[model samples]
Target: MSRTQSIQPLIASRSAAHRAARSRIVSLVLAIACLAALVFSISGGEYSITPAKVVQILFGGGEGLENTIIWQWRMPRAAAALIFGAGLAVSGAVFQSLTRNPLGSPDIIGFSTGAYTGALLALTVAGGGFALTSFGALLGGLLTALLVYLLAWRNGTAGFRLILVGIGVSAALASFNHYLVLRAELDVAMAAAVWGAGSLNGVTWAGVIPVSIVVILALLGVLIGSKSLQMLQMGDDLASALGMRVERAKLVLVVLAVLLIAAVTALAGPIAFVALVSPQLARRLVGSGSLNLIPTALTGAFLLAFGDLLAQRLFAPIQLPVGVVTVCIGGAYLVYLLNRGTQKIRS
Candidate 1:
């Protein structure tokens, strides 16, 4: 065989090997995510169920209320965490890809703040039920994102300008939420506050079903548009040069991210940081510089699932909000990232 032909075959073989390696890495990550889910599903709070028992209960081979406990109660919480994590991670990946900035997650962009505001309004002003509250959160989140987009449109969006505008909007919304909490009746405010702290403590399977349906559908939507999203990351000029509709793709991703963020926010309250950190973490784990949405989503599932477990299990009788644990850890990481970024800029 000619050297040229031989070299081409070798290159193709190496490329195939690389792809296989990445596939294996993804498989490992997903397997770990499952184990984490199983571990957390049974090992929390006063019940102290074993993973084996939990598995049996889940699959319909258990004696006693272990079945009910796992199926009705813990299952919902565990499912919520998994769905919440995956949604946030995917949303973060979407935002980061579109904005071409690491700090471009929906929470960072003030979308979550908007959702929280809507939820607060529902709870306090509207006196709405759970369904209404969920709708309100969805409305608030989508509206905030739209408003930010409008305000940030000055001829066109520069990535950094969009980020700055979003940060400003998010900060304002946070302040407004605080004011709303203070102004509401004590019981109402307390309810809102406790929920705002971010717990999966009481989420039933009913709640889980709705949130899961929404998250799964929206994730499927994002994946369907993945090619467009990848093209989007190449920047407007290049994407346009390549015959891709830059604005349309960005709009789709923005809407998808908003939907994912709103869905989880409605179900779990504003849990903070999963969306911010998970995609970055996933990328590092998978050794991909680009968005690996599936792996990132799985990584998110693991992070939130385990965090919920720790919050519920570690405290004995006192059940901390799953959100509280993530925020504490996420907060520390955020500070570290900011400080590191600042130091690099200064140096």
Candidate 2:
């Protein structure tokens, strides 16, 4: 073989090895971070549960107050962080692939707002609306996503047109949602607003069950579509040329993405930024050269769990919304990206 031909195999082998090593490194770092976060999360609040007590509680060894705090309060929040993080990250990954745009998320498409609107309507109009919000949110999410899909479709859909329609729908829904909240009684409005801001403080087993089931199933669906996702990112014609069912794959992804976002939003309000930044952050961390669902999910979980933990403890008496914190951070990142875009043109 010629020298260039001989060197090609060696380069491929080294590239493979490097990818494997990077994956292992990410797994190790993320594992350590997750463990530390769990311990800190358990220990962060008042009443001072030791790490040992936390572990004991986790293992079902404690009782009464400590167990109550850990088992009833912190455990659900922590588990929520895990599931929320992973679900958002996976959903973001799929949407970005489908739209071929990093900014795409359920929130951008009106699905989240629709879910929020549904939740709001239940709380304000359902006559037991408070108790029925989640179901309402689920229905709203599905309807809004379907509506966006139909509106965006004109024989075949273009990602750009769909996004524009989604944006318009989102704006309209936001107005309707605000109007409903404003019309309601102050006490009811305050309660719904707090729930809308998304905190894990009062999450019950009842709320957890449905969200967990739907998100897990949706997560599996996204994973199954990953190969199609990679192809979809290359654009419609190229994806079709590869014998992939481009339209079908897009539909499945849109559905899974909608479902994932709907489940999380219904469970925790619109926990902002995880769906926006997690995938991009994951892509950066795992390298621009590869796609990694597991690592992305793990990192997303870490960021959200840690963010929620901070939100709960940071102000103590004031108790800022977890969504508020994520949004503040996410908003700053958005500014940076915008500035970076200007810098690109200057250079």
Candidate 3:
């Protein structure tokens, strides 16, 4: 009300605007990086094509081997990496915001493990078809989420409690997955192991199309509810005071995030740590207290695409799963994070 008080509020407003502008710039840079990674991924295989040639092929100018490699192979794999990365990152951001914990990522909190369990079960018992595997993954992830929530709920879910319960559930599910894999025939077990390692190899347009649609829809859902998510991050009492239905909003957020995680896992075989690391990296880049969904998604796309590129080229003719690369990187990051001390949920 006083002049000094009014000036202080104006200063805060200016600072907020400056931070928002910086965040937008960072997001744009990340988007460009992701695009560059996609191009590199598409053009960097054994029979290398230049970016110009890749573009030419996309524009229907190239033919024969170039056409088959770019259109039939590289494009689908690149597309899968991009979409799956974005989905996982957005899912991670939503869960982290919902739980107010840095470790609340889908991978860390049992969703990935649960999806893996489901896929393994489908492969071993249900004879391993795409539709059945996807269904199993979704069902498994959702059930694990429900179990974690129930275990963590005394009156309402707390971030630390949920994380603890999720870790336990994840451990149990990991054992279950191993058991299923061991029970399968040798060929089936080998195939399941390969899938579990999360290769982007052999992705065809048929698989990519449905995955793209699902990722797009799930991402739109996250964006639509982004405002509620932001409010929810300010603690349940404040969010309720601001006229948000905290519980309902949280439930919706959880469902959307789970759908994203489960869908990506079904498509990509529980690709490790993109969901966990991307959002954290994006937050560090933007220096934002609130979630930056677009930046997170872009960071994820870049990581996955780049990782896939490395996986393909690093061993030359002996391609590794993209998950192996990511796990190596993410595991190092996790160690660094632990050394930096645990970040607790903000009240």
Best by lDDT: 3
Residue-level lDDT tens digits of model 1 in 18-88: 86589578858686865767556665657778777666666778767777777776777877887888898
Global fold similarity of model 2 (TM-score) = 0.93
Residue 16 alpha-carbon offset, candidate 1, angstroms: 6.9
Judging by lDDT, tell me the better candidate of 2 and 3. 3
Kindly report which residue stretches of model 2 are placed more than 4 angstroms away from their true locations once superposed. Answer: 128-131
Residue 163 in candidate 1, Cα distance off native in Å: 0.9
Residue 157 local lDDT, model 1: 68
Q: lDDT score, residue 290, model 1?
A: 67
Which structure is stronger by lDDT: 1 or 2? 1
- lDDT values, one for every candidate: 0.84, 0.80, 0.88
Question: In model 3, where do residues sit more than 4 Å from their true spots?
Answer: 342-347
Q: Rank the candidates by lDDT, best first.
A: 3, 1, 2
Worst 10 residues of 1 by lDDT: 36-45
Model 1 spans with C-alpha error above 4 angstroms: 1-20
TM value for model 3: 0.95
| lDDT, model 1, position 117 | 94
